[model samples]
Target: MNRDPLPPLTAFPPVPFDAPGRTSPVAGAPTLSQLGDAARAMVPYLREQARNTELERRVSQKSTDMFREAGFFKLMQPARFGGYEYGFTAFIEIISELARGCASSAWGCSLGAIHQWAVSTFPEQAQQDVWGENPYAIMCGSYAPAGKAEKVDGGYTVQGEWHWASNVDNSEWALLGVVFPPNEDGTSPGAGFVLVPRKDWRIEDNWHVVGQAGTGSKTVAIDQPVFVPAHRRLTFAEASSNNPPGASVNTNPIYRIPFLSAVPVCLASPMLGNAQGAIEVFEELCGSRVTRGAVAGGGNRLSQFFPVQSRLAEAYASVDAARLLLYRDTTEVEKMAASHTIIDVPTRIRNRRDHAFSTRLCHQAVEGLFSSVGGAGLSLDQPLQRMWRDANMMARHISLNWDAVSSMVGQYHLGLEPKGQY
Candidate 1:
């Protein structure tokens, strides 16, 4: 891809929302640390509703409302648009904190909040369309390029179905992936996402699963082609890089972060929380649980046993390591983005590799401690079982697959271009 010199970003003029001395409800523009505290505060409510959320097959409106009020949806949004304008590390930390309460809720909210960051990457007009009338409009997306669009006079006519569109039921807009027909020159056009309003399409309600059930990741279909303005479409090639078209206007350094590194970091960061949650639940249970039919002592406390002690120690170490990797890599990438230094292929590859590897560590830690939970943990009511399921399901995501990412990392080290998404 050829690079262009980015024009100096003309600052957005001060508007009513940009009052100089105004204090927000949370007091001024909330900091990332404050956002994290808010996320942590929601854990009890999220944990209490985990089962009900699964039964509904979507996150509850109350939870969504809590997140919205907590300034989570604005964490990475532009300051001119009532957002915090924080970086990737803040995003990861907030998401992980929420995941510890409920993986599905965390995943749902993460995608919704992240799309706000993504919308900031579109053309200024498109950004205005989304946030002008309503700055808090959260967006959900389906990244698979399953829809077909035909180029027209003003824009493209989009049609077809998209699957696993998480948080769609609650969102006002959607970022849907599409394949465009060939140009007049006969060369194939690039794949991209079409930003469609909720009115343009309908939900298909097909998300039925044993894990992450509350994410509401259902299929959304558009029966007939809807005319989407040119400004609404963003190509993958542009999105996967640091220099997207929206950067010309938005001009925030956080938006300059590479897509591959940014997306996987947010997607996989929740697993760290899931693992930590499982450990906490297990340790809590261990405090009260007693071993049955003990060989030496009759009905000794589970925590007193040597096996339990060793497993807890190992699991703690694994989870700690995973958290460290996520924070270290994301912070480094954020610094590079802020400094306007291009993140090289090696660093991007390492980010991808470590993300998957870290997720694997989380999965192993959760699963390893699961066996010690015994029959009590087998019940659907048990938080440990739910955490295990959530962690396992998270590991199955295409971006978090260990073998695929590891292969890409290996290939890169051998002087070959990464053969996998990176």
Candidate 2:
């Protein structure tokens, strides 16, 4: 673990676990543990339809309906709009549990459900515009600033093409990133995200991929420019600040955590679960697998092999370590946010470093078990093959890439400014 040189942030008071319930105006929200059980119960159904989900190139409507009915989407949403407003751990666990069933489903749920929390952190009127008519409305986002927006009277007109907007089929709104051209003073205009309704964006059916095929991560294009209200926009500078515009009205501690540092955890959580599921599937298959021999009667069980045992042990260790670190960092960050402590620069960088490292461990765990599996594991229809494909593709995400994280972390430790996006 990376150690921080700064003194502990102990001066600010810590918010009690029940603080949200006592302070929040809303009533009767379910606890985080209760929501975890709901997620765990849905695993079997998700697992049963994993292949079909990939075949259809999207999560089944049945699964989506089940998730909505179970209140999974509201885990991180604000209490005022019928959400539990739970801490980050609940969100991580919910996504991880769902990933154990299907990585693509978990990816879609994590991306879609997390947007609810993101939208809540926006201005009050923006939140109302999103959830007032329908509290359960789902949203999607593309963070790459593919559009150019002109600053107008009430808002900006945005037109951009965004790819990998996961689970767009289930979303009624989108948060698209755009870069401002320039200001009248000739200063650089920074990048910000704009909110648009589903009617303004069109989905392009272009999500065919080898791994995580069921995510429905299709392209979303805005051909005609759409006007966005200024209140609905959040700048990257605002996101990096301790006090955002929403902090004036959204008093929940859940919204206080640093976005750039904490959002990576959400992206990495599902991959960890996918790797663990791979190990579980490997163990189940290896138990009954008989080694090929000159004579059928002389064949030995694959589980008895020393190499197989070593691989299983190694994979387990890696996955367990990864999960422990994920939970540990999450709890620490949540505690800091609750206490109204400013997450210093060093701590934020450390969070980014550990998240990427954890993702690397998950990939290693999956690869170790995958390599030991026989040719039967290569079959397209095999569960092991599916896990391998999903895990491999997941490891390829920019945030999870080991090389980028290592460089950024090294630069920070050396007292040099890190270049990577937080």
Candidate 3:
């Protein structure tokens, strides 16, 4: 792990977690073991909604309501603000559990939760702006830095369009990337995602794609000169290192962890969850499904061939490895957060690479299951098939790209210059 000089821990004001039994459950939220059980609790309901979610091009309100009733959104938000403020490991486990039930729903919950972490990263004013209204108000964001903001007095005039705003229906706020013109007499501008009220923007209903369709990832446009109070914006440079605003207020070591880890972990955790869901499906099939003996099987597919058995083992192991990798990283984050220490750039880079690998491992595991399940896996009616397609679509996300993460991580390991855009 790369070690950066530790910044002195500062005395900050009271935060959400200070208030117990407010936002989170009495148990202080679920651990990895507990979160797995929560996911299992929803399996029947998720199976019922899986097809409906896909058919309607969005997750059903009923399914998400189940999440709400289960106190899902509060898992990541601050307790003062009605969140569990649980460790990242618990969050990942819960997300994986949700994905097993319905990948899209899990994606919504996991990706949507990032807004909670992101909020804690911004100015106290920004945090107040969000939680000051409804403590349970959850926000979802698309971190793609592809918008423009002209600097002004209070804040910048933000105007941009962003896609993949998942869980738009459930969130009242959104995070948009804006490149603001420099304050100095130079053309150099800064880039970062800014918090925008859902009311200030218009949904474009432009999310039409093959996979993860239930993500409801529509395009959002912020027209006119939108006033995004300065506090609502966090510069990428600050998040890059040395200036995370949350450390001043939140004081949690997890909150003090790297932004690189924050973003990719938010993105890939759901994918890992979804892959675990796929493994559950494969296991179910293994237990009971029969196969054609004339071609490759004897009775049930479990007794058919040793090759599939090997593939199933690989799939199981891949998921287990992915979970363990993520578990280890988040465990360290939780530990560091409690200690209130700063995680260095190289460690952040490793976390990023691990995040990317988490997705790849998920893909590989799903592929292992997909290849073995044969024709049954491709049936749209089969839940495994949905997971298969969903995993493939998720793999292509920019954050999870194989080549970039590997090259960046490898160079950092070799003591080469770090090159990362966003």
lDDT of the candidates, in the order given = 0.83, 0.80, 0.74
- In order of appearance, the predictions have TM-scores of 0.91, 0.91, 0.88
Query: How many backbone overlaps does candidate 3 show?
Result: 5
What shift in Å separates residue 259 of candidate 3 from its native position after superposition?
A: 1.5
Residue lDDT tens for model 1, 183-236:
789987578888999998999989999888999999888999899999998887
**Could you tell which candidate, 2 or 3, scores higher by TM-score?**
2
Candidate 2 segments whose C-alpha is farther than 4 A from its true place: 1-26, 183-186, 293-298
Question: Pairing residues by index, what is the TM-score of model 1?
Answer: 0.91
Worst 10 residues of 3 by lDDT: 12-21
Error at 291, model 1, angstroms: 1.8
lDDT of 1: 0.83
Off by over 4 Å in 3: 1-36, 185-189, 293-302
Per-residue lDDT for 180 in model 3? 71
Kindly list the per-residue Cα lDDT of model 2 for residues 288-347, writing each as its tens digit. Answer: 777675754337776877878998888878877777776667777777777888877887
Residue pairs with backbone overlap in model 2: none
lDDT of 1 at 407: 88
TM-score of 3: 0.88
